[model samples]
Target: MTEYGYFLASEDYGPNALVEQAQMAEQAGFTSLWISDHYHPWNDVQGHSPFVWSVIGALSRATTLHVETAVTCPTVRIHPAVIAQAAATSGILLGGRFRLGVGSGEALNEHIFGDAWPRTAVRHEMLEEAVEIIRRLMTGDEVSHQGRHYTVENARLYDVPDEPVPIDVAGAGPAATELAARIGDGFITMSPDREAVDRFRHSGGGRQQGQASAHGGMKVCYDTDRDAAVRAVHQRWPNMFLPGELGQLLPTPRHFEQAAQLVTEQQVADSPIPCGDDEEEHIRSARAYVDAGFDVVLINQIGPDMRGFFDFYRTKVLPRLAR
Candidate 1:
């Protein structure tokens, strides 16, 4: 069966709110949780970016829902070796219910560390090494390594998970899909592109029983007002609709907001996001990922309507989309 999951957007809510939302999501019949790991929100209007690990700890106590990072950038800001330790403890706290989803990140979060943001090629190189280091550390054995982008001296995860934490590497194209297939336990993507999923599966991704899986994420604004929902997305996530590397090039939320001024409401309306109170529209938007062959699709409800969105999905969307 295709599983449907709720996405916990750390950029849009505080840690406490996220914990509460986790409870709400489980009560509403969502099967899993997907949260983003970021040091900064995409734009100022999105408001919050609490440490995701801390929130995950809180979620561990609050709900039985399995949790996964939508996609974290472990190649920068923090060492992959360190992320390994965190993910290990997270798995233990959640009783082996944790998954780490990683990707090449945006400058909004990575640039704060004062390192020159490397180009895409270098970033991918870093990601490969990072994943290798994480996998070794997850084995609960002492590890040391020196690679093209990182160096690790004697490190190990003391509070290792009973079962290894699955790693999902995010990708957007054929090249990235191939990398995820080679290095990740599963593949993660933001869009519901069947072509990309096909590339990933053919390159040795998708379901393999004991191996790689496919995951996808989507965003929606569940408001009573359609235009108001458009305004919300245009203001908080115009970065989503940017054509190319603008998201990775912009260094801060302020920089993102400045660039987002170029994104019009019409563009936001034209984007493939589910908006307003139409149940069918919301279901249709989410179905794209399922239709693309994703084993699971994580749904994010943008703006300040979390309760309403959850209620609507519980009563309307989820039942209609149940597999």
Candidate 2:
């Protein structure tokens, strides 16, 4: 069976709002929670970036849903050792129901330190090393390490969960998917790409730990007015539609906005994001991920239609999909 979850966008909502949304989602029957950790919103129109750990702390107190960072970049802005400490505490606070989902970060958040953004290969190397460091620190013993991209000296997580916190590695391609299989406890991706999921499974992903989850997320703008939905999504997330490494290289919101301006509203209207209030359209978007072998799909309701979307999803969308 394919489980369903709600994705809480920290880039779009404050801590209190997110907690409220988690509660609402739980009441509405979501099985898990996915939250993004970002230093900045994708665009200014998205307009919020709360510290995700604080919100996660609030979530632990507010809901029982299994929570994971849809993907956190431990290689930049924050050191993996530090992330290890935070993740350890979160796991404990959540009664070991927290998973640390990680990935190679983007310049939008990783470049705030003024450090040069490494090339793609270098970034992936750093992420691999960071995951290793996080794993060692979770052992609850002192750790010291020196690697190509980071340095750690006698740092350890004195507080940790009873067991090692599960790692959910995010990937979009063959190489990343293979690496996720090598070291990750679960696989996380936004796209419904069967080849990637198949590669991970064939490369020794789900065999261990009984069955590692293949977690996916997607955005849907459920509004009565399709034009308004298109405009709002275009304003906030056109950057997601940027191809290649452009989204990874651009260092500022203005740079992203400039790039996003080239994206036409027609493109947003034509994009994969499921828009409008049609239950069939929403279900189809979700089934694509489930068909691709995802164990769970976290749906993000874009714009101001959260309650209405939840109502429709609980009453209409989920039942049909669950069958």
Candidate 3:
């Protein structure tokens, strides 16, 4: 059975709003939650970026839903040792219902410290070392390491969870997917690409040792009026359509906004992302992920109608998917 989850976009909503959305998601029959971990929103129009760790703490108290950072960049912006501590605390707070989803990350968040962004290969190297450090620290044993990317000395987590936190790695291409297969407790990707899933499975990432298999996600806008939804998506999430490495290389929200101006409302309207109250459209959007062999499907709403989105899924979409 595929689990359906709500993706709480930290880039789109503030901490309080995210907590409320988590509550609403649980009531709406969603079984899990995926919250973004970002230091900046993609563009100013989306207009919000709260510290994801703080919000996760609040969520632990507010909702019973299992939570994971849709993906946090442990390679840069923050040291992986610190992220391990944070994830460890989060796991304790959530009573073992937490997953630490991590990735190579974008310059938009990681570049704030003025560290030169690494190339894709180097970033993967750093992430692999970081994941090793995190796992070592999570064992509640003292760790000291000297590596090509990071060095740690006399580091240990005092408040580790009874079971080590599961680490789900996010990937968008072959190199990253292979790394995820080699190191991850699970795999996460935004697209419903069967090839990526196949790559993970064949490249030694199959369900062999209790791996979570593939987890997928997509963004949709729900509104009674289709045109209004298109306009809203163009206004708020045009960054979604910015092609290629622009998304990974953009340094600031302003840069993202400047680039997003090129995306037209029509592009959003024509894309596969569902943007209206049409139940069939929404169902198909989610079904695509399920059909691609994803064990978990996470949905993120692109506009302000979160209440409407949850309600529509609760009363209409969820029932159909359940069948």
Task: Compute each candidate's TM-score over C-alphas.
Answer: 0.97, 0.97, 0.98
How many clashes does the backbone of model 3 have? 0
Candidate 2 positional error at 307, Å: 1.3
Candidate 2: misplaced stretches above 4 Å?
none
Q: Model 3: per-residue lDDT, tens digit, 1-323?
A: 88899999999889999999999999999999999999999988778999999999999999999999989999889999999999999999999999999999999999997899999999999999999999999999999999999999999899999999999899999999999999998899999899999999888886635646789988899999999999998998898899998989989999998998789988998999898899999999899988889999999988788889999999999999999
User: Candidate 2: which pairs clash?
Assistant: none
Tell me the lDDT of model 1 at 35. Answer: 95
- The global Cα lDDT (0 to 1) of model 1 is 0.88
- What overall lDDT goes with each candidate model? 0.88, 0.89, 0.92
Q: What RMSD, rounded to one decimal, does every model reach? A: 1.3, 1.2, 1.0
Report the poorest 10 consecutive residues by lDDT, candidate 1: 203-212
Instruction: Write one digit per residue (lDDT tens) for candidate 2, span 241-322.
Output: 8998897788887888899888988998988898888888898899999899998899998878788878878888888888
TM-score of 2: 0.97
Candidate 3 segments exceeding 4 Å error: 208-211
Instruction: Put the candidates in lDDT order, highest first.
Output: 3, 2, 1
170: Cα error in model 1, Å: 0.4
